[model samples]
Target: MSTAVDTGGASDLTLRKEAVTASADNAPTAPEPAVGATRKEPPPEKPSDTRRRSWVVASFWIIVLFLGLPIWWHTTSIYRANLPLDRMLEWSDGKACRPVFPLRISLDPGSLQDQEAENLLRLTQHALDDLNDFPAHHLRLQLAQKEAKQGSDVALTIRLTPGESVHTATSSLHPHLPILDVSYPPNSIPTPMSSSSGLATYIAAQLRSNFAEEQNIINYLLESSTAHQEQRSKSVSQDVAQTLSKRVTRSLKYARTYHLTFSLFTNGPSPSSWDIESAIDQYMRPVLDMLAPIHNFTLDTQVQLYAAPGVQSQVLSKEDLSAFINAAEWPLSPSIGGAPTVNFVVYIGNQTIGTEAAETSQSWLIPQWGSVYLLAPPSSVHVASDTLKQPILTFTSHLLSLLGTPQSGSLPLRLSTLTRVRSADLLLRASSSLGSLARLSLALKSISIPSSVADGVAKSMHHLELACASLGNPESLEHAQIAEAEAERAFFEKSMVGQLYFPDEHKIAVYLPLLGPVGVPLVMGLLNELKAWRNRRRQKAKAA
Candidate 1:
């Protein structure tokens, strides 16, 4: 602790210290270090700078999340409703349900004793079982519960009346019902305990003979389907098969309504009208009305004068038949609302065909669709209904075959078989359609399927289920029609497979414009920032 003392020196030294000016203003405002201080560490980075850099990265993320991604998703996304895709695939593959056909045959005890009727039913069933090779097409024989039920149960019933002969079989299929009259001697009736009898075999053989064509058709369709793998057999050869194939390929697929056009064509103005409406009403209406159970027919008649045949030569060749229709000039348009049209033309021509007049020259079937009848140029008087008797009769018979009616049966039996045939055809068609849809969906990955397609599939499946439940009945045909229509709708849904416009190159073109440029810069910026941060971290660690 030494005290300071001020001593006056020379006068000049004291005078120079009159006022001291402030030292030169600041060179940089820095904290002063103590004497002999070491170099000052650089100031730690400002927290604000770090915050600004983080905000830049965060802003980019916000733009991507709120704007860019939303726009991309909105533009590229497809509107696909939830479909039961697995179920559809399963159905197409025949994994969902196996279609089995069981026919219902009723046993009518109309006039026989209860014991005798029961015995006859059992014996007939046994014989039928022995004859049937396909278990899927089993015929179930149920006893009619009541007299009214008896009329409805069995497809056909035997009167079982006593007769002079040992056995006799007569069938009546007319304007009304399906009835088969079997008169056997009283002594030939089956005993209550017997499992087999001679009468049973006869009845079974007759029934088999009646439904043979229908059975063969069903077998053919089944063999064609993928539903059965090992059961297919070529029962008929190509020549015979060609004939049956023509029958199927030419015949119109079954429909609820058929349009029947009866036209009378004349080269000269001799026969203008043939009293067609009246003739059709008298001859054709009854059959059409009877067929109302399976199909509805709409009839329209026309008469055209100065109509020339497409062929002019006297003899018509096989090639001449196609041109004979004059399809380019004929007004035979298809009926609206999905029903197929059938054309029956009675051309009043003076010419004859094939040098022979008797060998189907007057009329010929147009494959499955219709028939063309060449009528003799009638007397030059106003055409009357009586002149059309032959043509109309021919037309009526042709209509049956065009509708795919079986060859060997009465009209009633044929019509019943038609219902069964139509149901089977539609069912198989629907199934095939489903398979095609599945294949189409799988093959074209980029194609879009609309919700309407799923809805149609659901409706089709529902109708198919209903149809399958009621097979071999008229109701089955109705259900099958619904199924077929819905399946077609599903298969051909307009929006389902949008024309595959966006190819791979198109997608690349679309994305490259926006994403390519924008993504590169953002990725570079992110990488640079990451590297800078990593370098800073390593430097800090080294210093520590």
Candidate 2:
């Protein structure tokens, strides 16, 4: 039966039925045919034409898989610029280099025969080798060719000048050069056959003692570089290592320039300013000029008035020392530039130091920055430039401690030790930075690594290699400083760490309208075809 609603008014409506009359033996069946309508049942439906629709749906997926997926991957994937991960890991692994400072000491025996000098050098070398427990830092003695007069023939030349004293060894450093004067007695030169000469043994022992600190510092750095499976050899025992690490920690990281800010802080307004410029020029300029080789220092001075310490009592307790500077109100902003800031503050206050309760004056080192000297100048008087004498001198001493100068040594020895310590400090700092970067890159798998960061790492590694090779030399400090700075730049790269957050709702909003209509038809067509195919498969199985 068919029912039709025809707007065109040409459709035919038809109904078909069969009538039956009762007969006792066999009922007669009658068919009421086309009196007013007709019956039409054409045929069972031909297999559906759904395969064409299915082909269209499959085509959409093929296009999406082959074309769309790749585009999305390219757009969303993080850009991981190629880093020399293996080499970087190798450097971190301590496998690429064994970090040895084989400082070559050239012997320049002005008038001695070559054979005699060679014999002495061999014997001294033998004695040094036997006495040396630290092989990483050693003095290799070699014959200096006269042509190296202009350049560094050796790290330090040990001149074997004949002296009038008894079998005694007197060592002296050349003020302007790296030469070490070793005066031996007139008759103590070793014969060619002797294995142990008194002079050779004496020289070896002296040289070893001279370089003991340098070796210890280098050893400390090597031990602390990276957390590897194997422990780095201990040239220094645990106690000495801990002490050296503390000293090095107090030292500022290597920098090309260090800004030295000297401030005069007064509790009241009486002594507002001092003649720091002239005083610095007189007392500190020469030293700064000399340090010009290793680090550039910029000097600035300020006078802060009406300041109060965190502890208002006349006596400052040990706990009150940290808060004494009044950092919140102080105008001690680091200088705007590339260099690190070293702040030296002269705190002019009536506050007495707890350590020196009897005397109401003292100062303290701020460790790696500068020192704070508390000076309560004469009451009812203004502090003139000359009044700052004691305070300035105190600041100078504290400045030495802040700048990583050793406790027990001459000024020259302290400065030299500062260089070696700074070098080691920077080396360890760089290594630690590299380890951090490796960990960060590993942790944030989605973050991008720019090529500039890779380049900086490579550059850092290069300088680190050079620094390690030239450890204990002036150039080692330069290289280590560069390496540490570069590593810091690479680790905290501004562009790399900026948070680029994109909300999920925003991504959904972006793609929903475009995907919705297309996806609906695709999904519906696939479902319809699947239902039809399943029905056909069921029919075929029943027939089988």
Candidate 3:
């Protein structure tokens, strides 16, 4: 019994001990507080530091506004000089210039007295005015006094004389001068107080006939210009307009001088030399001398050997003729001057034109450039002047067309017409150029206008004003030429086009790296300062 009780008590003590140990292991316990340990919080910002950060951001913004932006703008902005845009447009519209040609025809009564000559002049003037439909081109007849100079401002001088046949009048244009020689019957001459006579009517009709083509051409020019619609003449037919258009396109641009280059191109080196100088003097000098008043010509002759044509075919077609001039291989550069070069090529080749058209000629005129003559191979090493006669004549005719001379008229008359035509052309060209410049200025908002362009425009406008005032006179040609040159220079200013290639992306690429890093710090500082100020205000409100 004693042993059983002892065993049971020992078991009970062991169970109690195990249970207490387990309970102690599984039960939660409070952790002991550590010495010198506290919750972590951000350090309080100093007012000075805060103010410094605020000032840093403020200074950055100020620099951006006052210094950085201004520098950027100054570097990138285009310098546009002020221009008279309104005045330019106005000049282009042709409201500023009205062209009028008042031709003065002097009547020379060789054997008649002063009173008879005066009556004849008055009657001729009345008849001419009545016959003239175009007021722009009208003839004013004046009796030539005994002391009058030979070549005055008179467009034509009508010399009256007694003809063998009564009631018969013969009119002839002077080959060299601008004089019209008229032979009239003694009885046909208008006496004092005579209202009308056959001689007077005949002179008026003949004058009208001679100037009819000139009138048409002038009317065409005015019609083609930017003049008012009412100012345009309706007398030109569609066929005539088409013909005139071709002529205008085929003609060279007006210039004070033309470089005439006579080149003798040979396939082989045998016929290397040519008597081009003598040939030009014989055949072309007369016309050139007459054209001296309108344009000056400079002559240059060269011989090129072993010069190959552009095409290899023996028989050239009409289309092949254009490529005949080997511009790459040939040293046919323009003369070193302001004058345009007119190349007269006498290509020595056996190549024949294959065209079946009978109207086709061996020589052809290349509009605005020059004429090309395909000649047979010369028998000798040196080409004679006689052999070049045809070519020189052909060149002379082509030169007239190149000068924008009228097709139908004597050399003197054609040259006279050319002066007036050239003046009108230049005036219209200058006006058109001004219009283009104005439009370009308005179209390209970013294009820079240089001071040179402004100056050129001003000079062009000044010359244009002078040209308008003297539209019908020879002085107008000089003024119009200057105006055209100035206008062209202003329109094609090189500096205006340089900035077009600089894109905004290129500017951004250059500036973004520096601006990006600097801007981020500034913006973040400003944002943080605002947040801190808001937090302080909220805390103060809570405490209150």
Candidate 4:
């Protein structure tokens, strides 16, 4: 009975186990967790940590914006001084100044009564006014006091004397002095009641003819300048304009002083020394003394032995003459002291000019530069003053030409005209220079302008004003020179040119290393902070 009971229990246990297995098979199983569905999430950042990170990014940017950028700007920024741009443009356009020359002509009536002289002067002035077409030039007649000496204000003196014939007048210019001698009949003088006089008309005509060349030259200058082209009256004919243009171009630029370098160049080594000093003293000193009122000259001489010219032919053609000066081999370095040098070369060679040019078959003027004279090979090793007379005379002529002395006037009158011309030239040159500086300042935004440039501009403008006011006087030349010098200084300032080479690429190259590493970390930190802030905002909105 025990064995049977144990068997029954075992069977029951087996049945129970099978039933558990069947129940396990029939019951639904929990689905396996999807990939990453049960992964452990990192802890949320603390509010303090997030705020600190944001503060760090803001601090970096604050330092860059407030401290670093300011420092960089202060260190690298160009200091540009303010300039008077409008005034400069106005001066260049010839709107600021219009030059007028009022020539004071003294009327010396040697034999006429005071009333007759006054009447005659009035009639003469009227005639001159009627005849003159150029408004820029004016001829004013003044009565000369017998007791008073000739004043510096007087440009020319007209001396009247009674001629043998009646109702006749003749005029002649004094060679040495600035005097116009007028020989007129006793009856030619105007009475106090008369409206006109034949002598007065004759005098007016003579004066007009005397100054016609100067008028034409001044007209040419006005027409040639870009600034004054519109202001010109176009009174000069085409042929006259061409001639005046040549003269203008051929003349040297005006300066306070001129250096005269007389050189003796020899093909052979025989003529070693010359009596240049003595020659110049004899033939050139008088002209220099006369020109002292207008220009001061400093003289020097040199002798170059065995110097070969650029041209080697025995006969030099007109073209060959142009290249005869051996610039590479010649010792024609300009003198120091900032004056233009006029070189007069006396070449001792057997070569002769083959062509019959009008200047000379033996010598030629180089136009604005100098002159050259070909001397037949000298007999002596040492040149005497007598041997150099011709060359010295030729040099004097060339010096006058180089100085732009008018061809039609007497020496004193020409010098006077030259003063006015030089003053006008300098005035225009300064105006043009100021214009260039203004345009340069506009075109080059990166260029650094210094306070010195502004100062120079101020000084130049001041002098320009003074020059314009004194255009007809000698003081005009002085004022114009100062203006020109200051303008040049302002235009050529060294500091302004340096900034042109420091380009944007150069600035990048200079600042890249300092800015790159520091900039990257700050930028990345700011971006991460911005992303975190955006995520937090989204989470808060979802929870709401």
Candidate with top TM-score is 4
Q: Which stretches of candidate 4 lie over 4 Å from their true place?
A: 1-32, 35-40, 356-360, 501-520, 541-544
| Model 1: lDDT of residue 61 | 71
- What does candidate 4's lDDT look like per residue over 1-544, in tens digits? 3553457878999999999999999999999878867777899899999888888889889999999899989998889999999999999888888877888999999988898888999999999999988877878999998999988777789999988877578888898788999999877777788888788889999999888888887888787777887656665888998898888889998888999899999988889999999999999998899988778898888899988999999888889987899999999858659889999999999887876653337888998899999998778899999999998999898999998888886887777888888888889889989999999999888889999999999999999999999877888989999999999999999888777677788878988998799889888888888998999999999999
In candidate 1, which residue ranges exceed 4 Å CA deviation?
Answer: 1-54, 107-111, 142-146, 149-153, 167-176, 193-195, 229-241, 355-360, 442-445, 500-502
What is the TM-score (0 to 1) of candidate 2? 0.78
- 472-527: candidate 3 lDDT, tens digit per residue: 56777899999999999998888876766876778789889978998898788878
Q: Write the per-residue lDDT of candidate 1 for residues 1-544, one digit (tens) a residue.
A: 9997656665656566543322334235788779988897999777688668867976897899899899979987777555566766666665655555566666555667898888988998889988977544667666666636444324555445566875554433333656565666667778987768887777777767766777777767666676642333345456656666777887777778888878878788786667888778777778888788888888777787878889987667667787888776667657756568888998888655663444436677887668998878767646677877788888888888788887876777778878887888888788777778877777777677788887888888888888878876678789888988888988887776455555678878877998888889888877877887887889889999
TM-score of each: 0.83, 0.78, 0.82, 0.88
User: Per-residue lDDT for 91 in model 3?
Assistant: 77
Error of 3 at 32 (Å): 12
lDDT of each: 0.74, 0.74, 0.84, 0.88
Query: What C-alpha lDDT, on a 0 to 100 scale, does residue 479 get in candidate 3?
Result: 91
The runs of at least 3 residues in candidate 2 whose Cα sits more than 4 Å from the true structure, single-residue gaps closed, are: 1-48, 106-115, 143-153, 172-179, 226-235, 312-315, 356-361, 376-390, 405-421, 439-445, 465-473, 493-524, 534-544
Lowest summed lDDT window (length 10), candidate 4? 1-10
Model 2 per-residue lDDT tens digits across residues 379-443: 54456656667667776676565566666434555566677777767776777788778877876
Q: Model 4 compared with the native: what TM-score?
A: 0.88
